[model samples]
Every structure is written in structure tokens, then in C-alpha cells.
Target: MTDHYDAIVVGTGFAGAFFLLRYLQHAPPKARVLVLERGRNDCKVWQLRNRRTSSLNTEEFFINNNPEKEWLMSLGFGGSSNTWWGGVARMMPGDFQLQSRYGVGTDWPLRYEDLETYYGDAEVIMAVSGPADSPMPRSRPFPLRPHRFSDTDALLKKTFPDGWFHPATTRASAPTGTRGICCGAGICELCPHDANFSISNGLRRLHDDPRVTLRLQATVEQVETSGDLARGVSYTSDGQLRRATADLVVLAASALFNPHILLRSGITHELLGKRLHEQMPVDVCLNLRGVKGYNGSTIISGNGYLFYEGEHRRQHAACLIETWNSPFNYRRAALRAERGRWTERAFFRFMFDDLPRADNKVTVNAANPHLPEVTFNGYSDYAQRGVDRIPAMVDTLAKALPIEEIESIEVARSTSHIQGTVVMGNDPATSVVDRYLMHHRIRNLLVLGSSAYPTASPAYPTLTLSALSLWAADHLFTRSA
Candidate 1:
């Protein structure tokens, strides 16, 4: 490997993959890019055969004792992409200006309009299947049609046409050359059909490019900065210290490690590692009276925005509702469900948005620099209030559909969406990176992924952060060239 490179991109998940893909396309052909990955490049077959995303364990890189808290992620060449369920949704226009519109959290430096084109771009790259109609505005339609919705989702959509609709997802609705059609089996993490989008399945070409040199099992330690610019990065590989210099450095390591690397590099903004969080998820089961569910094409068949936005967000957090089609545990309850009427229930996931809290954060492990100390203080009253509104929300659902009893409502351990920590805003005093995700102190350093999120929107972060990466690369290199 060369001692110098034009650009060094870290992590190969949605953020890094999208950034590097655009960088290679927009940059001159001779431009040399170095890709650093903390995990090894394990292909889809290996992951499936082994029944695991990586050879490495989560605790090996992160240490925490926050009671009842967990962060779900895969740390390999594909990063968390290997573990996601492939449900993609765009942030509402109001999500960008939570403070301005609802008088609650802080506003993002960029708005939904700024990212509309790039959202479309990311959708096109993944060939996302979505509906012609969307709750949020879209400049262009999705590349593929929407996935089939369950009977419950059909009723919900028919009742509330404005919000409830099929979720835009990476799980293939139809057969593609690289992916098989989703069998509606709901095993997205290690999809037996190879349906959902993963780095190995979709964006492997980004690393395989002749101009790009990919180094796996290389853990980045710190960004080498000089004056107000990021020079490169220092990392370890095979128990040997290594250094690579580049004109540009992209930190795509994720919410946990991005802030840790920044702290290790001495870029200690007061809020650098603060507000380490993800959406608070609550799972609900509805014992239906007449509705029969479980007829969708993927795991999460529908999304509901009826309770997602509006003036209520001023007092409490916004909510995003997800309707699940595949109840993996249906067989376990078969005896109680009556063999012929087994599909007469609906499952849901209610995700609540949260504001940044300084108490919840990521810190450098005192014992091991390779590991991160994750501390979570817990969700705020706003999120709790949103959770408290669940019964009322269920009442709204009952108004639309047949009367049913709520079988269970339990808070999920984790959504695996690790966001915040390294927040992005126009203000340098309060934020680590700017609107373009460039470090406030270092010009050439760009921190990619959900780590830049100022506030946790009820919507999914993968598509938004992926769009931001595309927008950042486009803004930096002038894609028109």
C-alpha cells in the first residue's frame, strides 16, 4: 500500500459506501482513495453459512453497563448494513426544523428540500421499492413499486390515506440480477433469499475499483490533523501501527466510534461525545376481532405517520409507527390462535424521537483505546409522554379498524440505530461538524453517518444519513465537473 492517498474513507457501511462511491465517480480517474475497515470482508454466503454477520463480537469493540440497554450492529467491511431490516423512510420536512416548527428540539443545518435529490439518488442506487404516493414530498418516484402490504396495513392505509403506506425498503419486491425476490420470510438480518441490500451484495464495487485500495481488519485510532486541516489517519493492523496520509479524510465509523476517534484526536468540543442515542422503540401486539394480518412481502410491511408530527410534538416527542407482517413467533402461539385463524393478529413497532442529552454519551475507554465507553442516561420526558400516548394512539387505530384488545406492549431493548454523539449544525461553538458534515475545527475532515444527526427523527436514519453522504460528496467535489 502507498504511504499517501488522495482520500481516506473509514468504515464501509451505508455512509462510507455511499461517500466513496460518489467520491470515486466525481473525482478524477487518477485520484487514489484508501478505504479502511475495522472488520474483515465476509461475504453473504459466509454470513449465512456461519449464521453471523462477523467473526468479531460487539463487546470486543464496545464496553458498557447501562442497565437494559443494547446497541445492535455489525462491525465488518459492511458495518451495520449486514444487520438492518431494510425499512427505508425519508424524514418529514418538519423533522429538519423541530425547533422552528414545533418549539421542541434543535433544528438541523440542512432541510428536507436540500436532501430531496440525494434521497432520490440513494433510492435509485439501492433500487428501493416504494409507493407513488408518499407522506413526505419526493421530486421523483422510487425506482421500483411498493412492496405488498398486509391486510392490516391495507385497512390502515385505506382509513388514513395521507400517512399509512407501504414502507420503502431495500428488500427486493421482484427478482433482480444480484438479489432474489423476498420470500416474505422476514429473516432480513441473514436473509435466506439474499433479498435486502448489503454492502457485499450492492456496493462491493466501490471497494473493488482499481483506484481504490481497501484494507480490512484495520482499526482507525485517530485523525492526524495539522493546523485546521485533517492530514490523514493513524490506525493499527495486525498488531502493527500504520499511518496513511490523504488530502481528505472521511470518518464513517458510526455514532459510537466516530466520537471516540474525535475525542482521541483531541478534538474535544463540549458536545463531541454527548447525546449518543437512538430512537426509543416499543413493540405492540394487537389481538384482532375480524382483521387477518401477515400478508406482506417483507418484514415491516407498512409505516404510519398519523401520530408522527404536528403541534403535539411541541409538548412530546414525535412517533413513527411500523406495522409488521411476519410474526416470527406465530408458531409458538399456534395452539392459542386456532390453526385456521392463526393470522388474525397484527404486530407493530412504535419509534419515538428524542432530543440530545449531554448525560448520554460516548467516551474513550480508560483501559482500552480500541474500545468505547457507552453511557446512556435514559430517554427524556418527551419520549415518555410519547410512549404514554400509546393507548390513545391505539384508540385511534380501533376507530379505523375492527375492535381488538391490545395483547402486549413492551419496550424493545434496542433498534440498533446508533445516532448522535457528533452533532452537525451551522454553529461551531455547539456542534462538531457543519451542514456538509465537515469538522468545525478541521476543514478537510468529514464525519459521515447518523452521528451528525442533531435530533432523532421518528423516521429511519439510514436513508437520511446515506443521502447526507451523497450530498456532502457532491458538494465537496462539484459533481457537475
Candidate 2:
């Protein structure tokens, strides 16, 4: 007994969701699509039981790294989007042209304009909200209106005047109708109120579609390929090996897993696991004596952008000053910095975008389990530069508001949005996928997600990734038709 489909998409994250939805909507009527998800399908149960479980606990990130530390990631229907805080934002035009604007990285083969329409469509599907005019050039109006600011956010806006410019409120992928307000379940774990939108919702819609079939708890072990064409994928499910064949194969398992899968399949292209990009998040916590309502509210409210100027001659870096106050977490983070420090009152988490450097990369560990290994380089210089810019940006905010003292600051690895491995380009020698997201070596294979991003931008990568997936689907459909 063998399973066959017209298309098979791997991974059920944002990229996978977009690909599944677009193919069902636009693929030839007779084309059958099968989505292969390595995780389970229970979003609520996974969120409730394993919400606190660290993503690094599994073989994905923990194999060669330290065993004690727990990384955060959800392996379920929605993928990481299930636990995501749902900060939907578009990349600035400058992000798309980083190579031309600055000599750091390669420019995207496709311009921002080329994907503008798809971005609009993705916004509708995700139900994102933002002001009519955003800062990005050639921007279009959002499908849904902007989300209103909370009471705490309004106070922060009034208190922080300089350097802090409150652009339109960032959008989330949550449900739009009745259940819009966030219950503030510390979205880092899970959205208990169902206010957040993950790919699980999209999967539910396609459950009955005869053209689509979803296989769960099926870990793809090998991609059987003849030369450059992938014939099918072999996997282990229910303690048994199974294989599925498809005319077209899409790798949407994100930057980390996508490269790992390719490496395991023995496709060692020069750029398979190189050029990793991560948006480094830095936290700046302050103790404001008179501020209330900090603990019980949404963590992030508004952000500010500062273009790097003068002698550095580097591309501009953007920083987000998010309003957050969790007494326990803040105190714990503070104590970790300098033992026996009690942090009370308001706090600000400043997330900064570091320019993507080519040195940072992902590789498979040959000796131990062949799991994913990430080596992040070039952060020392960026950290030193952050020390200078962070306080300056804070000082600009202190002028408008009253602050008892700037308590403590810390930087943490951002698991929310990671991009750039298997980047898209016009030339196959320099990139894994071509302009249409088709692998130059394998005509029937496609690579989707922020992995196709040439540079990591300050904004959240989900909306942009969704739009790119739609664009790729369109190209696939046109070529197949």
C-alpha cells in the first residue's frame, strides 16, 4: 500500500500553513496535496501540558549542546506559532536591500514591490491590524484596522518622549471577531484565551478538503532523491517506517530543521546551512516608583527605529522598546545579573535587530546523533555596540517620563523569529533556491519561510514569511498549470 499526492509539504508552521492554504485555493482542481507534519495535532493539550517544556530539550537543539538547559519550541499542529506572541509586522524596505544599501549581506533576488500584493493577502488570512500608513516604503493599507493600545501602553507613550516614537500598534495573528483581547497568559508559554492565531486554525479549515491529507507524529528520516529530483520522503510513524511520494516537495520546516533535513539527506551544497540570521532581543528593565498596572498587561506595546550613521558606515539597526512588567520574572532576571537585587515597578524590554553576518551558521554534528548545531558568531561587536546605543535610547525616553532608576539590563536569545539558511537568490551557486523559491538543482523542490530571507530585519518574520509562501505557491501553480 502506497500513498501518493500531487504535492507534499513538510512542516506545519507559518510557511507550511501558507503553502497548504494557497495550494488548495489555487492548485489545479484535480491536484491532490498532502501535508506532512512531524508533530502532534493537539494544540490545546500540548499548550496545557508542555507549554513550559523547553524546545532545547529534544534532539532538535539539545543534541550536541548542553543537556540541562531547556529550549522553548512547540512540536504540534501550529508549530512554534502556537506559542508565539503574535507580533505581525512587515520588513522595512531597507531590510530587503541590505546588500545594496550596506556591504554586509546579499540582496534578495525579489524586491519588496514584487511581494507587496502577497503581503496584503497574507494580512487578510492572518487578520493583522496596523495603521493605514506604515514606515516602510511602497506600503499598502492593512486589511484590518490597527489594534488599539492598552492603558499601560498609553502611559509608556506619554512618559517616553524622545527617541521613542510610537508608530501604529503592531498586529497579531489572533482571531479578529469576539475573542480579540489577550488574556495575558504570558504568551511566551501559550495563549490560553485563544486570542492568538497559529497555523492550527488554518489546518482546521483544510481538515475536510479531499485534496489535502495531514500525517502527524511522522518524523521525516530521509528524502529519497534521484540526482536533484526528490522522489519521496521516508519517515517513522507509530514505530513503523512509512514513505510518501509526490510530484513536488516543499521544505518549510524553518531555518533550523530545513537545513538539518537536507544535510541528513546528503545534499551538501555550499550554502545549505550557512548564513544564519537571528534577531537578537535585549531587555532593559527600569524601576519607576509611581507607575502601576505594569505587572498585569501585554508585554510589548511600541518600538522605535534608529538608523546607524557616521563612521560605522553599516546598515541601520532598529530597537523595540516594549512595555512589560512581570514582578517574578523581572526580579529573577535582575537577580541573575547581580545577586540580591529586588526589582519592583515598571520595566522595558528593548528588542534590537543586529545586522546579519555571514559568519553565523548552522551545521549538523556528525559524531553525535547528527542533530542540528548552531554557532553564532559576530555578537561580541554587536553586544558592545548595543551597550552604547541601548542607554542612549533609554535616556531619550527618560526625558518624558519619571523614573526612579534604571535597574538592570540583560540580553537573551530570541527564539521567536529566526531567519536565513537556504536563502533565495538569482544564482544557484550563491543560494539554495532561485527567485521563484524553486531549487535550481531540483526543479520540483521548493524552499519556503524566513529561511529564504537574505537578511534578518527588525520586524517579526511571520507576516513576511507568509507572504513569501503565497508568492512561491503562485509561481508553483503557474509553472505546473
Give the alpha carbon lDDT tens digit for every residue of 316-365 in model 1.
Answer: 98899998778684323311266666778888899999887889999988
All candidates' lDDT scores?
0.88, 0.66
TM-scores of all predicted structures: 0.97, 0.85
Relative to the unseen true structure, what is the C-alpha lDDT of residue 408 in candidate 2, on a scale of 0 to 100?
Answer: 72
In model 1, state the lDDT of residue 24: 80
lDDT string, candidate 2, 1-481, tens digits: 3587788888888888888888888876777777888777775655567654223234554342433222346665667876676676667666677667766556889888888888878877766656554556544676555444444455555664333333332224234663355545444445566666666653467646877788887777767789878897888789998888989888888887788888888877887877776666666767554444343434444444433222232623555555553444523543223333343345666655565566667787767544677666544355346545777776765665556677677665453576787888888788888987888888888888888777666677888888888888888768745
Weakest lDDT window of 10 consecutive positions for candidate 2 = 162-171
lDDT of 2: 0.66
| Candidate 1 lDDT | 0.88
Q: What local lDDT does model 2 show for residue 340?
A: 38
lDDT of 1 at 220: 94
| Candidate 1 segments whose C-alpha is farther than 4 A from its true place | 329-336, 479-481
